[model samples]
Target: MSTIDIIGLDGYENAYPRELSGGMRQRVGFARALAVEPEILCMDEPFSALDVLTAENLRSELLRLWQAGDVPTTAVLIVTHGIEEAVSLADRVVILGGDPGHVRTTLPINLPHPRNRKSALFQQITDLVYTILSEKDYEVSPDDIAVLNQGMYATFQPAPASDSFQQAASLSQRKPKSSRSEPFEAFETARPTNLDISEEWAPNQDSPLRYPQLPAVRIGSVTGLLSFIAEDDVDLYVLGQRLQLDVDDLYPLIEAANILGLIELNEGDARISAKGQRFVGASIDERKHMIRIAALSAPEARLVAQIYRLLSQAAKQELPEDLIFDTILLKHFSPLKARKQLDIAIEWGRYAELFGYEAPTGTLFLDRGDEPAE
Candidate 1:
């Protein structure tokens, strides 16, 4: 109880929840839980409501108590929506799938205690978790996925074999010092042309009309990610693992890039498309213009246009974000899907300068300052 630092708080022992600050109240809750001396401690986003410093302090204190065995609890399970928090705290992270939840993967945290954020090893582990979470339900052959060691390089094989071994050190020796840190060099020899993915799950490569459900990625990020893929012919899973973005964070970028004809997804592998190359090489104005044109062609953009027209015809130039959220989006999609689509819509409008969002008011309107592409 004293170790959590609530003991020194003035008159905290007698203070009710209403009397204490949010952080103090949280600490009291922690102390109360610890007082019982239970064998296992399970916390559901304990420090979520606290400020940054308070959360940090609590995380550190909790780790100390867990490591020192100062309390009766031997094991602690934390449920957090924050990926970085999970990576920072857990020895093994069990990723759960949606709906009827089931374990997707259990990743072991091998980084040392009090992990350094700047270290390559720590980044590798973080990226690995992101890769796991970003995975899609599409059927992927084990061979199509590039398996790296300790978040470094390895040959991507379509099938398992003993002879297909390459050392990162040896690969690094052959490269110039400047390129040594580049991850995909080891897989250069194993790079295959468009590994076969099932047609059902693969995006409509032939049709320009159909678009995948894209993540709400900004134009800048979309271009940067496309450029990286152009330079490195990496697998989607491998790329996400390297970038350290889970499905929630990664897939949207992939979908957006793909939709904009900025990248190509063949099997599980992602490569930059010709248009993406041009966009990457173009100036910011050129890139924005291209994205604006691309956005005009997308289904989401059409919906935004429709809403804008409807509002304008009704003698209103603006509409509440929630109005669109509840009426059109939620009507057509599930609550969760609707929320994601709304996010994507807002991002699209802003990036193309097609619409403006007043976040304070949660309203969307025509972006008069954002001139249309001439």
Candidate 2:
């Protein structure tokens, strides 16, 4: 009772989870977790789905409880994409880099509690963390920059698009690395421009059945993003600034474009690829074909494409929705991400004319009634 009350669900004890709002349900989750009063609490991107104010309120309450010694947990471990959130909460910030992800560096945040986000020191720390996350873990040699200057990144593009593929990663699996890092002057000197950073960022093989997530974007937005890159290259940080979004938020869009060979990421810049050049000019039908081929081709987005294919082939191009949720999406994505991936697949696949679903029948088929016109 104390746990539930502390977590802000004072009168909702008898309420079913379905009756609660998303944020309320999240609070309920915290209440349940705290009921046992475990020694350590581990949270993975816990606030990612919440609205900004709700997430802020929740974090504030959690901090209040911890500061006042109201909770029994000795330590809270949180994995998040929000840098400011990390800095505001974590005492030690561990930066993860490279595919198969490893800690590249650990920087201690020695700031006093109840940190000020607008302060000069806070901005400085955030900048340092940004540079750390952006940099390749390995030292860059001048010789490497010299080679990359000769247009080596062009080769980073995937094999020519195919009409069909059994595995997306097999056909679309490309090794992507481009060079450049703006060094944080606080701890490092200026970095060389035009580097071959292939070793830094590459697709994971997911050897032991690891699942890749679909970008939290729709197909329509991707077209606009591609068009922006096609017009002229743009730095990722610059884009983030313009959009008032975190740098991490932009990576998914970049990855989606990279998976489809619609754009190439170099250093912090996103430049259009040859396929992207064609995509901008392609007709509606041709565009869908391009996307379909790319989906069945790349390692990153390939799994989602494959899942869509499985759903399509099941029951001769028609299957129950339960089959999609229980057998397909859930198998690949975590429970939290499975429904999102389904929504993503539905919206994205429709743009590619990929597949369709019937709600009442709980069937997967090739119907495009709601597909947007070009």
- RMSD of every candidate to native, in Å, equals 19.2, 21.7
TM-score each candidate.
Answer: 0.40, 0.42
lDDT of model number 1? 0.54
lDDT per residue as tens, model 1, 260-371: 7677788877776655555543433445556655665544344544444434443456778887766566545678987777666665665555565666677777655545
* lDDT of candidate 2 over 10-103, digit per residue (tens): 4344345553556667878888788898999888998899755346545655765676577899999899999988877777788777678777
Candidate 1 similarity to native, TM-score: 0.40
* Model 1 alpha-carbon drift over 4 Å, by segment: 1-213, 246-248, 300-302, 308-316, 335-337
The C-alpha lDDT values of all candidates are 0.54, 0.57
Best candidate (score: TM-score): 2
Per-residue lDDT value at 89 in model 1: 74
- In terms of lDDT, the best-performing candidate is 2
